[model samples]
Target: MMNESHAGTARAALPLSWAKRGLVSLFDSALVGGRPQQRYFAALGMAEDEIFTGYDAVDNGYFAQQAETVRVDAAACRRTHQLPPRYFLSLGRFVPKKNLPALIHAYRLFLNANPQSETHLVMVGAGPEDFQLRAQCVKLGLQVHEKSHIPERAPASGKWEQQRGSKPGVHFYGFRQIKENPLFYALAEAFILPSLYEEWGLVVNEAMASGLPVIVSERAGCAEDLLEKGFPENATFTSISVRRAGLRSKIRRNGFVFDPHSPEELSRVLGLLSSVAELRIAMGRASRVIVEKFSCENFGRNAWLAAQAAIEKQRSPAPAPARGELMIPPA
Candidate 1:
């Protein structure tokens, strides 16, 4: 939600007295998505000690394990196709907001800078932007991954179709084994998502959970929230408390966050990630750590706690009569 829209201003006009009430909250961010229907309960009006945020997150454990499985499968896929050892992975519909067309331009720039490098750009998923994506690939003298896919119909082989075309740098492998897609995370040196405008790009969460270093658009919600927790210690988390205080930190060094409007900036990030293997490993580890905090289980447990807190508030006894005031009880 790019703040300051007409509706947002109207909603922000909500009464200030709502702040002065008994409450519990589940706001995602402090000020994002308008003034928030909760106002102070959304973390602004409540005492710092009482605010809660039931923000959304992906299943870290599930995605992580799937990534490990794909890690093994990655080798076979790479060998069978003779794909490049160093490559970047992207997953999303070919929508304009996803900026795949711009990503292709950035990929071209990356190739121009690293002509001798064997790095490839393999983007998955399909949408209305498919034809232009392919045209851009061919226009830049980039090779395409020829695997026909119908959005619904199964391929005759009952597997993600895979074939080779005679181009080198960019590979647009449309739809593949829908179930085994997480393997794409295992096969990449890094993951990139440079959206034009995204309230939240969940693929960022999946990619990070899969142990791939990420480069997200600054405008994407996960760009900040994924990095919000910074680095977690090497211990198992038993629960997620309702407070936003514990996990939130200022030290976010997980991955690159660049301007989506600047193709040169995206190209620079791609080039940097492509050239530095050690950097990718370190950042990818940090990504794994950060994502662990935002796991599906953690999100659920924390939300349960928040619900309990609100119920407790609902059930609490009001203060007894003070001075001349009369006491009243619920009938």
Candidate 2:
């Protein structure tokens, strides 16, 4: 059994073709990460029974519980870290594939459209593109505040909110540990993952579990299964509801899905979420409900089922030799 997820426009060439051939010849079954990944496997002539989705997941319970704890003292955490009262959160490596430049440009457009909006863009991560991204922020005239290192398990300083100087700008909170992320998620109003090509964005899961509306790139592997939500809060969460919501997902989006290449589209989404508090709240609630179905336990169950299926297939006897065909005996 194989467990890999790489299905995006960027992977469209000789490499992917070779990968498909290898997969078909080498693996009897595969555990995929998302619905889009199933399509990739299906294209390789794999049967539905041979392809298992939902192989990627995070500790939703841990993120949720830690976020709840942060919420209990959100004001203090925000002040100590000097985070904006309301902001858009983006958690990922600052790489070209992650499309950090496009996000920053869209954020500029969003700020231009709503000059009075208080929402800021907070990016958390470090990579080779770190300096380039910071330069872009500076060229755009966006105040770039850098919080390079966060002490692990350090007590929060009792700082006053007014003294922290919260403002609407781009904040770069450098690489954070798993335990330190919930505070950033808890204080955020929404999450954005604008990757040019993502195999499976697990940060989307973390954000959803933390109860924030998400804006995901259409190219992300998880978008097909985790991005769309259009039904009202009162609607039941079922496959039937999903089908019904699919009809209105384009017009009545809760969790937004946008083309990563189009900064205008992402800008518009940012503006909408910033202006409408009610819409943000509704979408955040829906995100939590949707992400609950894709828990770590669900991933474990699917993996076990796939392994069992592979074992069963192996245990089945080989077909009888054709008539007059001689079988060679090995010494």
Candidate 3:
């Protein structure tokens, strides 16, 4: 039912019990949208009789239209320098919940294992927790690049160079305008979202729409449905073991599972992605196919239908109580 837990403290301040009851009374089918969230709603007194889940869909048409608006004008994008062969792009705030540390560790491993690989990682987004992450990346012997709003000059502190070695390729593009993001996405070879947990990774879909291969963590809710439904038949599913559970479980395990705690595992996956061009193209095509199904038009239609059904059921009269004698006397 569009659980709002992601709002965290902000949601907790509201009158959740009243809100739940009000919502239940208003709709026929209460569709719980995220993993772990259905249970949260249940705890708020929502019953299985009223709750519905299992099918998670988004308005893909809206996103597709949004994707179309990306600027093809290279001049607007400001390509100050040539991009590396395999650009590892990550777009998320430098927050712990976004799991930047794990990604950093995995990236270190990936670089160490393939020193000759002409790959560069571009992280977009900044937050309070960025300093420590920057320090860690430097300590690990990986190059770091910091992009700023004032493009005329670089940071005077020399911190970026100290942490990233001389002529670092890694960049922190401060805050590009929203319209300019597609330009950055256009430059990348592949998209990586190694979050420890995510309700639905919109960026994964966005990257796929941009025609880039994606490497997302299993914990992401979108991985269960979006990736599964969209993944190419030939694209290899990492982390899932068919030897343990055969094809069905393997399919279920595919895109939705990964060891976020292990950098080595992440490195291995990225390594495989970088090493094989055919695999990347196949996976990219599969991602596009899957994303098309989730278009905004489809999501709006389904959401409307689901809402209508719920309203219709809610409007129907409740069955009369049985004519049994009252168990307790009226006060």
Give per-model TM-scores. 0.69, 0.84, 0.72
User: Clashing residue pairs in candidate 1, if any?
Assistant: 40-45, 143-167
Sorting all predicted structures by lDDT, with the top scorer first, yields 2, 1, 3
| Candidate that would win on lDDT | 2
Compare the candidates by TM-score and give the number of the best one: 2
User: Across residues 16-55, which tens digit of lDDT does each residue of candidate 2 receive?
Assistant: 5655555464565778887788887887666778788778
Predicted candidate 3 versus true structure: per-residue lDDT over 273-308, tens digit per residue: 676666577766676776676565655555666577
Give per-residue lDDT, candidate 1, residue 22: 22
Q: Which digits, one per residue and each the tens of the lDDT, describe model 1 over residues 145-180?
A: 644443333334422223454334665567666465
Candidate 3 off by > 4 Å: 4-27, 31-78, 81-83, 150-157, 162-169, 229-231, 234-257, 317-331
Kindly indicate the candidate among 1 and 2 with the higher lDDT.
2
Question: Model 1's lDDT to the true fold?
Answer: 0.62
Off by over 4 Å in 1: 1-51, 79-83, 149-167, 176-178, 228-252, 313-331
Cα error of candidate 3 at position 40, Å: 7.4
Best-to-worst order by TM-score is 2, 3, 1
Query: What TM-score, to 2 decimals, does candidate 3 have?
Result: 0.72
Cα error, candidate 1, residue 298 (Å)? 1.3
